[model samples]
Structures are given as C-alpha cells and as structure tokens.
Target chain A: MSTTTPPRPRRSRAERYRSALWLLTKRDLRVRYSTSALGYFWSILDPLVMSGIYWFVFVVVLDKGGDIGEKPYIVFLIAALLPWMWFTGTISDSTRAFLREAKLVRSTSIPRTIWVARLVLSKGLEFLASIPVLIIFAVIFGAQANWNLVWTYPLAIILQAILVLGLGLIVAPLVVFFRDLERAVKLILRFLFYASPIVYSTLDIPAAIQPWAALNPLTGIFALYRSGLYPEQLMVFPIVMSAVISVLVLGIGLLVFRRYERAVLKEI
Target chain B: MTEPIISVTDLGIHFRRNKARRRSFKDLFAGSARRSRPGEFWAFRNLSFDVAPGEAIGVVGRNGQGKSTLLKLVAGVILPDEGRVRVNAGVAPLIEITGGFVSDLSVRDNVYLTAGLHGMTKAEVAARFDEIIAFAEIEDFVDTPYKHLSSGMKVRIAFSVIAQLDEPVILVDEVLAVGDKAFREKCYGRIDELLSAGRTLFFVSHNERDLRRFCSRGIYLDKGKLVLDGPIADVLDRYNADYNNPTP
Candidate 1:
C-alpha cells in the first residue's frame, strides 16, 4: 500500500504562534461585538466616562484641579486613564484566561502563554482604539501637547504591555489552582484603581511616601503617558524605575507560568 | 523501521481525590477532570507505548478510566506528572471538538478560529473554507451564528475543519458518533483516507466493530493500569472476558 506521511508546518514556529494569538484575539473582539450592540462603544466609553467622573469629583466638586494636576484637568485625567483601562482590563480578564477557555486551552498545543497574551493584546487593542478619544480631549482642553509623547508614549506603551502580559502569565495559571484568586484579583484591581495615579499624579502624594508611590510601576508608566500633554510630569528616576519594575514583573510572570503550567493543565 | 511518530515513557498522571466532579466550570467537562483530597490517586502510572508512523492503535477502557487523559497527554494538552510523551509531528485532535468553538460567532468565524487554534494558517482555512462547509453540509448556514446551528451541525462543522488539517497525527476520542448514518459513513471514509495516506491514528472507542475496523493494535486499560497490550482481537477478547461481555 502506498501512503503519504503528514506534511510539517510550512511556516516557522514563531509565525504559526503569532497567527494563532491574533486569531484568538480577533475571536474575542468579534464575540464581544456580536453579543452586545454597544461593544466598541463600551470599550471607548469606559475610559471617557471614568475621566469625566474623576474630573468632576476632583476638579469640579473639590476645586483642586490647579493644585493637583495640569490645567484642562480632563486631559490630565484621560491621558493616564486610557492606559489604566488596558492594565486593569487585561488583569481582570487574565484571571479567567484558562477557566474561560478550558477546553480550548486543553485542545491546542500552542504555548499556553498565548492564552493569556491574547487577553493582554485584546485589552491593549481596546486601549489603542480609545487613544483617539484621548487626543480629542487633549485638543478640547487646550492641553499643551508637547513633543515628549513621541518618545514617552511609545516607551510607556511598551513598558505597560510587558507589565500587563507578565502579570497575565502569572495570574492565568495561578487562578486555575486557586479559584479564590479569581475573586481576589478583582478585589485587588478595585483597590489598585484608587492606589494608582488615575485621580491624582504621583507627585501630588505626600513627600514622605513619594518614594514608595513611585515604586508602583504605574507611576512611572503613567508619567510617561502624561508627558504627551504635561511634559513636566516626566521624570528620569521614575521612568527608569518603572522600566526596571515592569521587566521584573514579566520575569516573575514567566517563571510562575512555566512552573505552574503543567499543574494548571492537570487542574483544568 | 520508520521512526515512531509518538513515544510515551514511564507515563503517569495523578488527581486529587477531593476535587470531585462538582468543583467548578472546568469540572463540568472533565467528567473525571483532575481531582484531589488531602490524599491523591494516580489516574495512570508506569504505562508506556509508541507508534510507528501510520500505525493504528485503539485505546480501550471503561469510561472514567483515563482513556481521554491518555489522548490528552499525547496531544500535548496536559503534562504528565511522572513521565513524558514526545511527538515528532503535529496533531489534529478530536478530543471534544465541539467544545473549542465560540457559540456567539458565525460559522465562518468559528471555522477560522478553531482551525487557527490547531495551528492552521489563514490561507489554509480560507482555502478549505468552502470545502469544509460543503463537507459539513452547512453551506446555507455559514454566515449564521454558531449557537443557532443544531447540535448535529455544530459537530459536523467542527469535525470538518479538523479533518482538513494537514497534521500527520490524528487523535480520535469517539467523536465519530456525530451526525446521522450518512454523515458517519462520510466520516468513516475520511478517516480511512487519512489512514491510507499514512497518517498515524490513536483512536479511543468502546464499539468493537469500530475499533476492529480502524486499529490493528490495542491497549486495554483498567483501573489506571495497562491490563494488556496485544492484537486488537485478543485485547477485545480480554477486555470482554474481564468485563463479562459476550466475546465476538
């Protein structure tokens, strides 16, 4: 009997992996849109709405815009808020990466990291889609759009992406073993929102704790974000610190994911 | 001798005795999904096997005896605790084909999504798109949401996509029960063609006729141990005698 052996993958391994990740991320976006008439609207709407609420509370209600942030406070609020949305959204969704697609996770031989990375990319894409809104607010508020964004914006995005994906890698597998971590991830995110620099700049925090505040990776990353509008917010020390911390988080995430992936697969 | 397409060594997987079937969303599918108590049990242990390219092997065991777990290991979906499984080629796995799809997406999208998950590129899926839809006989419903399809149609669509994958190793998990007789005949024909083309097959089934039709070698598993490793007919006879079923 004449028989033909199966052909190997024509593309390199990395190419195949990337396409798989993209396909999953597309599926995620497609489902989100199909299920809700307002899917795209909601992704962009979230940051805008949050920016408005914070601007109203801190500036309108508290009358502290001049004391706390750059002028045209809405711009200040949204500049950091957009990326914050990506960070929190990715973190929140990563908690369920394995559980949500347990069957698919078990079916594919692709590196399990793709599962969590897809969430990071999808949420990051939403943040990208919402950038135009940030620009509009920046324009409307007559916020001084400086050239620092050319460098800092990209820097901040890379740092945040690394940070979020690392954290996702860590969280996705861990949640499979400890289901309670899923709920705990949410609670931590809720606390992280206030603890991060969304409502106020890291500089506004008391001098006594400013060093510790900068240690929150978001402080430097967000400062890089604000540099697009408020150049003075950019600082050498914190951006350097953010880079160091983001890379460290990613390193830890990789180690945790590798150590637990087998256990996670068994648990799933 | 051709190199073995798959090799498993000292294979063992354990489960927690306490985390039973009711644990969470995962347990919903894992009928035996992994479990644990303060104590533990090995779902499988000290088992090993290999398949030369184009070899057809049938895995026979009662339900919840880790038959699916073995396939999962070969498919590289789950890690073994005590041993290892190494595969030289890609796998087109039918282990819960219907579970990988998105209910809210259209058939077109689900096809691309699932095919991609199995590592099929866009060009490949698009090339096989019409043929896959034609095979599933769901041409009219390609644009419709997947959840809208009948359960039978869902399986047909999923199976069609998997059938077209160029991967050399085909892992079947008794999913041939999908669709009607005519559809099953078509599936049988497809499996036959792949086998004739020298694809390696690892099929798990309870039906003696199906096992005899596809596999020359059989591995009989009982209570997490390899009870016998021999010819299909003998393994079936042994399995039948052990389980008190009338022999063929």
Candidate 2:
C-alpha cells in the first residue's frame, strides 16, 4: 500500500518543536545584537543609567545615604533593575507577537506556543548576560553576599522565566483580539515599575500595606535577587506567594492561549 | 482507487463588515462581541472537494474568489469556520511574505530556521544549504538581512526552501508568478521535476500555458463557487466563455 516516499527519518513532534524554538530564539538574539558592535554593553546601558540617576537623587542629593541601600547603593539598585527590565521587555514585546509577525505566524506549521516562549528565552538571556555587571558592582561596593546566593539566584531565574512565559502566552493572543490592549499593557508596566520593589526593598513597604503588596508576584522575585546580598530582604511569605502565583499564571495563560488561539489567528 | 489525500467537506470561512476594526470595550459590555452571527457573511460556504494522493490539481479563478483562502485552509494556517479540510500528509505551502523567517535574520539563518519550522532536521538543511543558496543565486548575500533583499530575491529564497521540503502535499499559490523570466523558468523546471516524482500539487495561477503545463485536472471558480470541474482543456474552455460573457 506504500508509494515510494523519501527515506528521511521522521522526527518526533516534540523534537521538531524544540529545534524550531531554539532556532527562532537564536534569530531574535542575532537580530537584536549582531548589527551593533557593542551589543552587550549597549543592551545593559539603560538599567545602569537608571541606577545612577536613583543613586544621585536619593543618596547624594537628599543625603539619605544609609536609607537607600547597603554601601555602594548602585549594586543593590542594579540587582533588581536587571530582572525588571527582562520582565517588562518580554511582556511589552508579547503585545506584538502575533501582529508583528502575522505573515510567519499564519504560515509556519510550528506550534504557536513557541512564538511566545521564544521571547521569554531571548529576554532571559539578555538578563543573564547583564549579571556580571552586578558582580563587578558587588566587588566594587563590597555588598555582603551569603553562600545562599548559589541556590536563590538560579531559583529566581527559573521562577521569572515561568512567570514571563505564562504572561506572554496570555498577552500575545489577547492583544491580537484587542489592539488597544497593547497600550493598556504599556500603562500597566509603567505602574508596575513603581509598584514592584525595584527602586526600594520589599522590607521598606509599610507594615499595613505589606500583605496587599505580597499579591504582586514580583515582590518575591526581587526579594530573591536582593537576598543574594542583603539577607533581610528575603521574606518566606512573599517568596512562597510568588511561587504559587507564577505557577498559577502559567496555568491560566495556557488555558487562555488554547481558548483564543483560533480567533487570534483569524484576527491577525 | 486510493483514498483522497485531501478532503474538504462543507468548508466555510467568514468575514465581517468591520473586521478591520477591533470591537470597543462598549461592544464587549453590550455583548455584541460574543456573537459570531451579526455583520458577517461567509466568503465561501458549504464547499466540498477532495484531491487524491499524487494528484496535480489546478485551481483557476479571478481575483478575490477564494483560491488563496483554500490553500491557506489546506495548509492549516487558517482554521475553517464551518466544516473542515482534512489532508493525510504534511502540507508545504509555497506562499509569499511568509518564508517562515524573521525579517531581520540573515539569509543563512532564515534558510535553516524556515526549513526547521517545517520539520526539516539541521543535518538535512545543512546538506541542502549550498544547493538552496546556489539555486536562489544569492551566495553573495548569504549574510545580509532578509528585509534588505529585493522582492524577487525573497521569492527565490522562499521557493528554494519550499522545494527542498519533503512534505508530500505542496501548495503553490502563484509563487512562480513573480521573479524574472529566467528565474521563473528555473522554478517551473524544478516543479516539473517534483511533479514527475509524484508529489501532490495544488497550483493556483492565472497563466493558462503554465497551468496546462502542470495540471491535468482543473477546477474553475467564480463568485466564490465552483463553476466547473473537469479535464484541463474543458475547464479552460468554460473559464474563457465565462470571461468573455460577463454578468450585467
């Protein structure tokens, strides 16, 4: 019953999906960096400049030297901002995941989730590359580091990746349906920047509002990053809340994506 | 005698009058966004057809009659709103503007990325890399970004990649209609080789000589309905008569 077909080995669906995902992630990174000779340096420039501005405003100008962070406040500021940039960048790009790539989105046979997941991976890599900036800052500022960093840093990365991937899957498809939601997401990110514990530690939040603040998943992620240098910033309650919320967001994201995928395809 | 490799049953897709406009939040509250019934009409409804394995089918139609939409449905890119398009084999769609590449990627990366997107392994793409590049006649621009390429060059790359695909069902939607005369001839020759090897083709084009060269069976479409389906010469005759005798 068989006609003579090509003898090439048929790869499993998962294998093909994985390879396609990696190939696309590589493309994103190359496109963002390959054209610029100082890609890595320029990529980290935004967070570095932001840290400096905050340091100048709070530490130098206001003379609140001890209030901002531990000695060499720049390390503390850079630690939280790097991951924040990763979070916001992925979510922002997610708005256009289907719209910007409509042609390929409608053409390729690859699983659609790869489109969202690739953004998380590429942005995560950029965040990872900027970690050395924190390290060199730590050495220069002499920020205290505990042996617990070995586990906490990587744990935070895994959590952030899951969180962003879930949010992206949810955002990318929904924006295809509601184009205005793209601008809505931008507004939310702006609020989230001040709302998240990037400029200040979670410990600094008023005791009355701390419980409500724990609802923000990032309160815990930032704690994990900061806990590497300042042990007091790590709180078990918010960290546990973040873990639960990250997993929950991912579950909801998958459902939202599956429900609206067809409509998204049509809309795009 | 064999089962049809592709089956379309009561297939329909709809378009809204204001499909270009996203529903406002007020529409969401008013519940108008939830209903799929209003301000919409089927582009093609209750359509049924099938293609047998290794069958080379020509789909001839005037502009905007749903030919390209049919190929999109078969390729599983656009979901059918009513019935379904069932194909037993993998579909390799030779479409434009979707070489399955990020526009910023280099030609070399795009070649690998696109082929991989369709399930071609790295080793397989590696083996055909030089062949694809040489066929496209763009060895000099291997490292250049895809967005910088001329439209003709884009078509060349798309064809080169799709031609290397092992997928049994190939959808060619006027892909050969573009590019210069010499390159188009080269593309036609490649298609001829593939057809001789028994690949299933769904070729759509307005060019009669080109259609006749590739297809033994033709289906003529007008007003989003199948007007005639028969031997190539007969279908071509009906198409011409309809063209000459326009509706008032």
Q: What is the lDDT of residue A99 in candidate 1?
A: 93
The CA lDDT of each predicted structure is 0.86, 0.84
Candidate whose DockQ is highest: 1
**TM-score of each model's chain B:** 0.90, 0.90
**Model 1 regions more than 4 Å off:** A1-10, B20-38
Note the DockQ of each predicted structure.
0.47, 0.42
> lDDT score, residue A128, model 1?
91
lDDT tens per residue, model 2, B1-248: 79999999998887676777676666533643335657776667778888888889898888878888888888888777789989888777897535476677789988988888888888888988998899899999999989999988988988888887867888998877779999999988888877877889998988888788999888887776777878888888888787874323
Each candidate structure's count of clashing pairs: 7, 0
DockQ of 1: 0.47
lDDT of 1 by residue, B1-248 (tens): 87888998999998777665334546323543344444578898999888899889999999888999999999988888888898988899988888788888889989988988888778777877888999999999988999999999999998998988868999999898878999999998999998888888999998899999999999998999999989999999988988888746
Residue B189 displacement (Å), model 2: 1.4
